[model samples]
Target chain A: MIVAEQKPFAEIAGFVADCNKILVAGCLGCVAVCLAGGEKETEILAAALRMHRRLQGKPLETVTYTATRQCDPEYVDAMADLVKDVDAVVSLACGVGVQYIAERYPDKWVVPALNTRFAGGSVAQGVWEERCGLCGECILHKTGGICPIIRCSKSLLNGPCGGSQYGKCEISKDVPCAWQLIYDRMKALGRLEWLLEYQPPKDWSKSRDGGPRKAVREDATI
Target chain B: MNLTTESRLEKLLKRGEFVVTAEIGPPQHASAHEIVHHARLLKGYVDATNITDCQTAVVRLSSFAAAVHILREGLEPIMQMTCRDRNRIAMQSDLLGAYSLGIRNLLCLTGDHQSFGNHPTAKNVHDLDSIQLINMVKRMRDDRVFACGEPIKEHEPRFFIGAAANPFADPFEFRVVRLEKKINAGAQFIQTQCIFDLERFSRFMEMVVERGLHERAYILAGLTPIKSIGAARYMQKNVPGMIVPEELVQRLRKAKDDGKNVADEGVDICVEFINKVRKIKGVAGVHIMAIAWEEIVPTIVQKAGLYPRPKAD
Candidate 1:
């Protein structure tokens, strides 16, 4: 999931400071799942902007619409009829969706209303935490399902370093040592021998270290 | 007569009969027709109509506006204000605005978390919890000044502030303590979360009596009729801290099996629940939350034998 948090109200106001006719776009994809850019949230932001603009004696003509998914050309094309009259479009989707809107509507300026954060699930009722780094690698089979790459502060692959104490990380007493959890899980599963095997260093080229990635199949193309 | 806050609460308590109250949900859209309709339905039958502000975190017409509409329709309104959307500054300003509009009764709540509501991206400003909001109202009533040291030259608001409690939400022992804390924070009355299990309510009332808070404030039990078997199941699983007893569910199921009208059976369940609550010694009244079924409130009140009695001093 591409998690994002809505920018502060003041910052949003500043972004649309010049535009009189603004289209506040919302995405019903990953951003909606995280409660960042859903239909309801789009309306609220529009209301707040209207109220703030009224208070400042600078009225604005704001229209809100939520595309099924902002990342796809079909969904972004659906909003073309609504975007004609607007001076600028404020995209409330993730970075990819924002870029897609900008690419599709090259004439109109597109502003991002959310800061895309890492992919994660809600830890508790109202809390969200990062879980994956999207490094384009899967090493869980060797680490007993615990990803030391993301969970460990140093992202150490070998084992627990001298910084680990009493199952806790040296960086913070509250943080559980990721390698310790990995060791305990492997020991329980009789897979402790996997840790002793010398593994090659991760290839960073497949990740963001290289340029933007794309996937295509010649047989599937029309 | 400009009655003091104390005098108003005292007058309600001294009357001693069941004080009926009804809820008014503010509209999400700009239209006030729905709010006015509910207010008109409950005008004379209820003592006060509660205007809920952005209930469950969805944006709605301001409670202050709803209260004004209620007052215009010649009914007292209990403005339900939650500390979810605004900071202390805005809350204080809105309170003064509500007072200026002649709204006297206030129900303070630490609103439902924004995650549960439709607007997930909306930032929640829990500047002050419910207890602190109650205290702020009390301060404004007494000193006629806000936390920011702003003086009110206008007539001071004599607000009969109320709070909410969920006896079924917490352990039995903690319910009493929570009620006591609310009372200490200057809550003149309390409307509990929906009550399905009367036996538990009786035990809760017993605890209130043990703490000597039964006499200090009016405790209004909340009761909502279960419209269908699906609704009964939904309440048990989804609604936090709500316990719909097996007997009531079984009764509704039986009603369904008999091929009788389900809504009428739901009303019968509500009537029975109200009667059970009335027999409990410490329950001052019952707040019937018939969600979107405002038309049936009068019927429920009439069935519960809670017609507006002559105020006895």
Candidate 2:
């Protein structure tokens, strides 16, 4: 899932300061699950924006709407009516949702209210950790399901680079060394021999390095 | 002395001579004066000097460029390369460039994380790990091909490859195995992290001897002379993969209480470490890393009876 966190209230307030009225948009996708940009958050942001503006000399109005999934065109198009009277649209979804809303409403001023963090899932209550690099290829079968691409600080294919001390990464004690985890997992599974083999340099061209990527489903396309 | 030896360190180690190497941290500012000064100070006392590649991830004069400065001082340089800053393309390009500039030895490392550096928010490019980097360099030399296996139509970079080891790092049982892994990946020599816990380092060397890894590649013990009690305490609390024993710290404190220079005591401790590790089987040499205090290296080398470095033509 695409994780994100809301922008500071003051920053959001400044974005719509000149506008008399604005639309606060939310998504029911990854941001909602992460407790960031959901329906409840949208209302809280809208009320705060109005109060912040009212405290100043000028007053502001807000209309809030939460889409099923803001990345989809159909869900974004549903906000056409709510966006018509507003001067600006404040998207509380990931970057994708802000772009989708902007693409749907060509002339409307759309600004992101949240910063898209990474593609990860909630680890515990109110906590999330990244799990993938989206590197276009997966080698979990060889590494005991541990992904060094995103987990290892150096993204080392052959690692536990002398920096692995006490199962923690050299960067921080809080961050567990990914190669250590892989070593333990492989050792437990009697696959330690697999780690002895060298892994070649990754073909980054398969990743974003090749440019904006696309996955076509020719059979399912309309 | 092997007057015609191109790689003094490699030749000395092969001839079973106890060699010595020192590290020179390039200046953060754009100047080669520090490098040249240290090279001059360490010329006749050490076999070769290692030019660090942004040690601790802080930005500094590049190791390759510093290698050139060291060569100008009539000293051989073991140019260090890290995977943190470059991908294979840039690494190979620098390898060729370093060799073209008369740099002979190469030390490949998976550098310290960027978060520890001055540029904390910088993006890192670990496109290759140390093991793979060693293998790539070996192929580029032995097979006369690039990392992609394409034949090198021109002169190839034939570096005497070296890798780093941390005997004090966790999963202590696996440290020796990883050393063997590095040797299998074509590392001609191994320089370990600084050793303050002699007992633990001795045990790590015992395992290496049992497996006969010492026969495959030369092993060099790393030593660092502590400047003061404060620096010792800082390394104990902050530096990763480092073990600064309390006993050594107390010795420095005792020196301060006796009204003696703490730095002289630091050099004494370093010289003592060299003598102890020298007796251990399979320990080929010592690599002193007297950071910011390269002038003390000559004293330590002389006290340890490793002075009058072998001449190589």
Candidate 3:
């Protein structure tokens, strides 16, 4: 899931500094699960922005709405009328949602409220660790189902680079060595031969080496 | 044919000479006096001096800007670039810009995490890891194209590529293999993480020699002097990826207890390390990172007998 965090309240207020009317748009997709741009967060941010503006002697009006999923065009279209009325919108979604709302409502000034982080899942409550590297290619099946691309600091196609000590990455003690996890998991499954089976340098063309990627399934297309 | 000529460091490495290199950390503020002073101090004593790109992830003057300033001082600069701050787009453009300004050597690094820096809340853009970045730079120089395979009409940046290796970092067995990969990815030279553990560093170098990687690429031993017991303790407990031997820390503590100047002992120890590491098989040179204690660099160089570097033709 794509993880993100809300931008600072001061920065949000500055984006619509001159305007009196503001719309706080949230996404109830991955961001909702991450607790970054959900409905509750959207309302809290709207209230905070109002408070900040009032303190600055410029009282502002705010409207809060959480779309089912801002990434979807149908869901984004639901907010078209409300978006047209607001002086500016502070999108509480990942980069995709902010652009989607902006594309749908070209006349309205749209600014992102959340800074989109990595693509990962929650490691614990309130802590989301990056999982998949979003590399176009998937090599999980071979590496004991662990994604080294995202976990390893060097992202070596082979096993872990030299900095793997005591199951921790060289960059920090907090991060577990992805290769060690792979080695341990493979050892448990009696599949250490995968380590011997050398994986060549990653063919990055499958990743973001090309321009923006696309997925057009024939059946899903019109 | 190789898309460019050799750099000063490249020529020295090609000749199998014992190279000595130091680091110049740009000050956070924009006053060029500190940088210029460092450039002058490092000018004739080493093959090349590395200007760190936001060393320790703290924002500072651009390494590229400092490198150009170093160049003006009649010294060679190894411009360090990290993946932490830029995406592929910025990386390519910056490399081109640095080259256009006459910077020749480039060090690719996966910089320290942003959380470690002053701007902890800033979002990191690791558009390319160090290995990918090395390959991309190699492609730009040799293949005459960017990572996206787009051709450059003129002035492709032909750099003498360098990378960092931390043998003290973990999974000791894998260190040699990582160095091999860096060499394969077009690293002509490598400056290792600071060396406080000679036994472990030897084992790491032994593996590099076993794979004949040292023959393929220039491997420089990294040395950072322990100025005080407190400083040593801080590195032992705090510095990530650095492994400072307990014995060294004890020595510093002992010196402090004796009321002797611990800084001199640190330099004494560093000079010995330089002398010892220079004799190690496949270890071509030493990269001294006396970080903030730049004043002691010339003394260490003189004591280690590495002063008066050979003129590169």
Candidate 4:
């Protein structure tokens, strides 16, 4: 799922400071699962903004609503009436959602309340870790299921870049070296030879470098 | 006769000579004056000096421009490029730019994370990691084509590629395998992270020798003379991927209590490590990273008897 965290209350507050009435938008898809821009987060931000405005003797009127998914135009269009009724829209979703909202209502002042982090999973209760870089090409089949694109600090194709001690990254004790994890896992599977295959330079054209990419299925077009 | 012998540093390593390279950190503020001064200080003492690209991820004068300054002073520069600040487009363009400026030796690194330095909030563009970068450079040189297979007909950058290694970093057994991969990716020479744990480094190098990697690439041991006992302690406790053994800290502390200059003791330690490391099989040279104290580098190189670097005719 897409992981994200709310921007500081003050920053989010500043985004809508000039507006007296605004819509605090939320998403029920990836952000909701990650607990970032979910329904709860939307209300929390709405309340925080209201209190902040109240303290300044300028109370704010916020209408909080969550769409099934903000990345989809149809779901985003559902918020059209709510968006038009308010002075601005505070998107409590991933970057994709914020942009989608802006695209749907071109004139509506839309802003992001959360910083989209990465494609990751919940490692523990209330904690999330990044696991995928969204690199168009996925090599997980050969890497022993470890994604170096996101897990390795350097995103090295052949790594554990001399900074792996005790299976941890050299960057910090909190982060485990992705290559070390892969090596150990591959060793366990007796497929260590998979690492010796000399992965070539990544074809970044399939990645963000190729500019905004889109996927299409001819058979599913209908 | 490797086509890359065009660079003096590469030639030195190819001849099996103990090459010495130093790091020249460009000043944060705009001024090439300090950079030129350091180049002069290191000119005769080291075979080539590296101009770091925002070493530690702090913003600085771009290393491509800094290498031009070093080259202007008639000193060969090992231009450093980090993935943190550039995407593949800028990276490839900068390589051509730096090479056109007369910089030959190249060091590719996956730079320190932005959080490790100032401007922590800045977005990083690590579009290409170090290993892939080495592979890309090799492609550009040998294939004489861009990464996308577009051919380049003019001023192809013939570089002696280099990469970094850290023997003390975890999964110690895998460090050698990583080094081999970097070489396979087209790194001709390597400079390790600072070496304070000799026993551990010896074991790492033993693995390199066992694989006959030393025969393929020049391996330069990284040596950074501790400025003080406090600095040593900080590195031991705080520096990521660095391990300052307990004995070195005790020795530095003892020197301090004895009222001996810690900086001098630091140099002694550097010399001692160089002497010991020089004897290790597969070890080719020492890369002196006298970071802020660049003035001490000439003295350190001299003390290590690497002064009067071999001249490439």
Clashing residue pairs found in predicted model 2:
B3-B313
Model 2 lDDT per residue over A1-222, tens place = 998999888888888889999999999999999989999999999999888888997899899999999999999989899999999999999999999999999999999899998888888998999988999999899899999999998888876888788899999999998988998999999988888787888888888888989999999999
Instruction: Record all residue pairs in model 4 with backbone atoms less than 3 Å apart, i.e. clashing.
Output: A164-B170, A164-B171, A165-B170
Ranked candidates (TM-score, high to low): 2, 4, 3, 1
lDDT (tens digit, per residue) of candidate 1 on A91-125: 89999889999999999989999999887778786
- Tell me the TM-score of chain B in each candidate: 0.94, 0.97, 0.97, 0.98
True contacts kept of each: 0.00, 0.73, 0.25, 0.46
lDDT of 2 by residue, B76-132 (tens): 899999999998999999999988999989999999999999998999998888998
TM for every model, in the order presented, reads 0.59, 0.97, 0.75, 0.89
Q: Which residue runs does candidate 3 get wrong by more than 4 Å?
A: A1-130, A133-136, A141-144, A152-165, A170-172, A183-216, A220-222, B1-4, B152-154
Error of 3 at A154 (Å): 7.5
lDDT per residue (tens digit) for residues A97-204 in model 3: 999999998888999999999999998999998999889989999989999888876565655643556778766788898988887788789987666554544666
Superposed on all Cα atoms, the candidates' RMSDs to the truth, in angstroms, are 18.9, 1.9, 5.8, 3.1
For model 3, the DockQ equals: 0.22
Clashes of 2: 1
True contacts kept of 3: 0.25
What lDDT does candidate 1 reach at residue B262? Answer: 82
DockQ of each: 0.02, 0.73, 0.22, 0.49
